[model samples]
Target: MRKSEPGRGLSVPRTGWRARIADRPARILLLGYLFYAAVGWGLLMLPVAQSGPVAPLDALFIATSAVSTTGLVTVDPGSSFTFFGEIVILALIQLGGLGYMTIGSVALLVVQHRISRRREAAARAAFELPSPVSIGAFLRAVFLFTFLVEAAGAAILYPMFLRAGVESPLWAAIFHSVSAFCTAGFSLFATSLEGYVAHPGVSLTVAALSILGAMGFLIAVDIWRTLLRRRVSFGFTTRIIVSVTLALIGAGTVLLALFEPTVAVLPWDARLLAAFFQAMTAATTVGFNTVPIGNLAVPSIMVLLVLMVVGASPAGTGGGIKTTAFATLFALVRCTLRGRRDVLLFGHRVPAEKMRTATATFAYYIGFLVVASGLLAATEAGAAFEHILFEAVSAMSTVGLSMGLTGALSEPGKILVIVLMTAGRLGILTFGIAIARTRPDDTAAPQPFGP
Candidate 1:
């Protein structure tokens, strides 16, 4: 006899696709993407969304990658997506990178009304916003930040592109503007930024855009506000972020330069520029590699591995433990060394709960990458562990760098990478909460113990 789930339907089982999607987070951003994905899927089915109508799986993949801001694409983005499709993809990337809640708040404020509490709360939790804000204030800051950065980035890049003589200056500017602002790091060309290895105009501009995007708007606002005040003082969080970011950039650049001996041959200034650019991009989790990464020595690759694991700032575009978590964790270590009772930074003591969250986040990140690498080795047969780790790190960080192995991956490998990209973009912690199985009743037995 066949059994069915509780109350779905006669024809369709209770454990349907719809049921699975329902229990996910209250983050409206995720749901909004699903809605767009369905629409994009339907669009693909139409004769116009594609050259000959893309397969459902490909459409869903494109939609997920764009909306999630994960640049792992099986189909060539330039050839398959038309102007309309490209617009849709860009819109999804911008909205996804900035969280739909952000866009909603911006819209509400544009019309001169308050944002709903639900949206503000979701946005707050995602970005760890410190204060309760009326939607208009929050919206103004977000739109302002986005426009200023993207516009500045485009202005810097347009002349460079004109000099390079790319076919469509307008299209190139727009594509890059969206890519940089979203921290998507996705390029229309197949080679990514490989051709721009020595072009500081291209590299520096992209790196700046990525760094700004990954810092998240709140941090940007904080830094900007502080700068505007012309004060030497900083808030606790801002101090932590600034200090950690500078340290990471310095350390990461040194390591990258030391590891890549070939880069050592370049003029000191040029090498310094490349190292700084690469470090900034990696730290921000924007995987635009100006230099050919696959040829890097193992030591250089290791440096990149650490940077990928560390990841970027909170809530902006990049992924990983975030600069704050790293700072908090580092403080915890320092506190232990100095034998202090609390993990303090910038004269502020971090809460115990935040420590737990940071530790858990780091554990989840490392565990996911290790397991993913092991599985890739099993399925990929002849592939080395280095390549596997590279693939895994690239996926989990949503960094699009590859070892010339992306095209060689089998179907199963592609599936694994896709899962990693989605997980990385949505966040491992977020997924854990969603699929977590437990209740208050499931707690361990309470036995009285005398120690």
Candidate 2:
């Protein structure tokens, strides 16, 4: 080897994964999730993590689902996994829901009392926070809010679980509480929330936690600022997210209540409650269903499909195209219909960047849904086209509702869904960007478009 130049250290140039993702937050997030999923898969594959031998693919599927907080299960988690495995899944859910960077940042804050600029950039990208919001404040609020809500939810659920004759009521309550709040929808019960259809206390409590989690941390921060800190008013994004969420929930509830045959057969009080629970679950992308989703009529299915596509708000535990993006699409249409150029919502003009992002998100979602659905249709030749489409949407949206198709998926189908869940958890645009090639001169001024 050549001798080093005078005053030149022997440090070799940084190369490989670290250098590649150094400045790329999207790549960092994407790989971070993959790393966690891989670790979770390995841990879950051990003998101690399983009650019985689990197929490798199924273990990987469950691990991915937990890390994505998507809640789709190839096996009944309760029966297939032992206590240790369940804890592993729960840990994955918490990590997934909180996000890899978020947890890392919090830990750093606790230990070092300061976050590095690079880590701060990653956290900002992960959350897509507004310029006015400080990353430190937001992360602290997120941690506190998550634990408080989860604790309260568990407390409320403990007595309900005990009354319902559940085995290990305390553990069941705690597990389900975290699951709901994370909007992970992983249930210890074999039939999800179906057994609690008539239990308004449980249904509503779980629904409340899911809603709170899915509403996005920005909303919580906004509320804290407005109500507690005496800030001037709620942020525009918060207002829109709340409005769209409530509207979707309300619309889904009414449509399902009116058209769902299963809900129609229930007693009047339980019928409305079930419909509301199903609607809220779908809208929040929480995946818990009080009624059997498989037996629902076409109209009810359609309603759920819409809700899943719209999904929860941005910077939230849940996933989808997102409420703001969906709202922006509607605003664009309204403006275009009136022969105007400015996209306006709730008296505020939408920024051009936001409009473009919304349009791209909508296009990507539709494109991915169609492609995945067609592939599923081809792979599962005997399965109904409707079910294939539903599964595709559900997987891509990270809304785990299935029409009795999940357990019976072919190997290829399972793999496809795994990809979808990963993509869904990593926002579609972020996933696309992470995989796409980039130029060193990306900061150069934009050039005119050409056909």
Candidate 3:
């Protein structure tokens, strides 16, 4: 590893990792995600995936949602699929959740983003790297972490499901494990584990998969390296993800239990468990819901709304504002409250640019949710605006948990979600990567631009 440059704090020197990330492979990964989404959409348009050839918009919607790992389906995935078709959707979910690029770029990057300037910028922003330069090691680390976790989750789950007497337990176990880790929330079951609502083994296993997978590959890498060396650097992502994740879980637990008395049918312990589970489910962007989210108290709905907005870790399948983004935003508020010059967490100063990034992410996320929800609500019959908003958020966050409304969406409603899912799966900023233009420092001339 190259030594740090003179002025940068905690950022690795530019010539090493950054340069590698700026190669063709990284660009390929970025392009692959869009391509895969298109393919998935194309498949959904086929009669095999649906009863008949679906309307282009509806087919595209289902495909994008599956590829994005958002469970906001316009049709019932359970009923819409023939065995072969459902398998394709499941495969798309796995691919989408793991990130088509992240998985496709499985081999470590050597030199990436060599051709596309937009890809370099997108990769830099997406990975939170200091430079858009190459980082073979980091990408490699991320892929390794992902594979191990998914494999481990699958190993544990498959046997359990088998013992529980599920036919095709092997395939079911592998699919769900991958889905959970990718935080895609696409399930084979029609009602999404409604039958296993309180099955501690099943639900808890899924929950563990959700949490671990949504923790973010970067965090996982950090944790593994830390454990190996018996020390932890306590990087910003680690500190924030750990603290905020815990707090959200606690807050969610209390809010779900306090605000919803409907779960009283379940024992207090079970209800509490379910409440905490929902909290984690939302925070992590893992769409598995042991209890139906729609039937809950309105307050619980609000709580979930907040949780969904907060979302999961960065650089992984889960979506939303992300824990770090919210953590920084919350810190900015804290700094204002204390009259401090900088936002602080774990006694480390949050960077000024980081605060801006957080604000932008949060803003864009909300903007999309609002517009998409409004569009869908306008098109769908017998759907509440709030439900539309929830569905939009689910699609945008790539969190698939939905009210029963999804199966009945109009063609237009389905198209709206398809757009949201594609955007969400691409991390909202990827479009920035797609649209952004960059100039070399040497040849770049000063350009007049509006602020």
Candidate 4:
């Protein structure tokens, strides 16, 4: 028998080990989140990070929520966290909402003066930016637009906060502005913009910021380009996202006004304000609520649940299944029912891969929603089933709106929610992909994410 080369076999195992670590981008992304969450959790546990001693679980919960940009909290951040703690949370929200990959690309651009092909590939994989939009352009536009919009929102909110007797209006304005634009839904006010329900300026400004953030950077870039160039050439995705957003907002506003008895009792102007704000909150996956979420009727809650699950557009700050996925699945069903082989959007054929991804993602969301809801039901059995289900969907969607159940959840229930919130913010498919490792070769190849 011929002797094998001495080092060749050893080299194969080393190569295989490196490939396992390097190739799984999805797993790496997931680990990035866990690492970030751990860091944030430790920071929150520091004496300066909170006003008083905090339970490790609660600290972890807050860290996960902040890192995921899911606002479900067991404690009131305003009363419980110190100024330093709030700053830490704000930083987490920024990092979490923009995504670590996008920020890393920005850092690369700053340091290297250009993104390497690998970095570009990473950004593209993370954000799913289409061919028409270059990574540099998208990064620049998203950063510029995010700050500008946040600045505008802060400018609008500062005076209102001052008038409302906030001790540190500037801080309040900046905090709320960033929170709204990131769709993080973390608020200094314990009631969560409830007192501002009748105040159009504050409510509307927050809603507008939420809308912009949830619209996704792609749509923002499209809008900015059209306005700057005096041209109107938006893509099909942008068109569908805008159309669906407006329609959902309109329908949600009407439904909330009609079905919510508390909202119905308000004067016409107040009712309109409540309706609009709630609609915006639900559709954008922004958790700020003008009306008491618990007071809403069952049907009204169902509407919100649907909106939360449908969520915002792809590559956006908000979470859930996404607007385009909902559209794709709807289109798929329509085509299939009609015996049509191709799914057509704006007279263009939709790719089969996207359809399958959308279908899988949708199924993932539904399946998980049921399992999580059932688990919550068992753990927090004392709570109403509807409220438990609502909480589960909200956490999974990264929408923070709750029916007063978050604080009452058992420790295990809270942990479950933390997991759901993390999963929701990362996205169902992304979470799944991260857990299910692919072959080294498969990981090396570029794979498309769902729309």
Give the winner by TM-score: 3 or 4: 4
Q: What is the per-residue lDDT of model 3 for residues 294-355, given as tens digits with 9 covering 90 to 100?
A: 78877888888888888887766688878888888988999899999877977888888888
lDDT of 1: 0.73
Q: 74, model 3: CA deviation in Å? A: 2.6
Off by over 4 Å in 2: 1-17, 230-232, 440-451
| Model 2 per-residue lDDT tens digits across residues 1-451 | 1245568866554556666686578888999999999999999999999999999999999999999989999999999999999999999999999998999999999999899987888888777677788899999999998999999999999999999899999999999999998889999999998999999899999999999988889987887788876765788999999999999999988888888889998888998999999999999999998888899898889899999999988889888999999999999999999999788899999999999998998898898888899889888888998899889888888889999889999999999999999998988877887777777788899999996
Model 1, position 32: C-alpha lDDT score: 59
Candidate 2 C-alpha error for residue 307, in Å: 0.5
State the lDDT of candidate 4 residue by residue for 1-451, as single tens digits.
1234586753323345445544555655666778888999999999988898788999899889888888888999998899999998888888888876788788888888798765676566566667778888799888988899999999999999999999799999999999998898999889999988899999999999999989889988888889998999698889988988888899999988887897998899999889989988888988999888998898999999999999888768888899888888888888889999899876778898888888999999999999999899999989999999999988998889999999898999999999999888778987887677555485386779997
- Tell me, by TM-score, which candidate is best: 2
Q: Each prediction's Cα lDDT score?
A: 0.73, 0.90, 0.73, 0.86
Q: What TM-score does each of the candidates earn?
A: 0.86, 0.95, 0.83, 0.92
Which candidate should be chosen as best, given lDDT against the real structure?
2
Ranked by lDDT, the better of candidates 2 and 3 is: 2
Scanning candidate 3 in windows of ten residues, the lowest lDDT window is: 107-116
**Total backbone collisions for each predicted model:** 0, 0, 17, 0
If the candidates were sorted by their lDDT against the true structure, best first, what order would they fall in? 2, 4, 1, 3
Q: Candidate 4: deviation at residue 163, Å?
A: 0.9
lDDT, candidate 1, 1-451, per-residue tens = 1245568555543454454544334334456556665675566556555655565666666676666676666676677777777777777777768775677677776685676665666666556556744445655777788888888888888888989987676677778877877777778766777777778788888877887787777666676677888875455666666677778878988877766775787777778777887787677777777777777888877877777777777657777778888888988999999999988977788999889988999998888878989888988988878888888887788776777666577778877876787677767776566556546475679778887
Model 1 spans with C-alpha error above 4 angstroms: 1-29, 37-58, 131-136, 227-233, 438-451
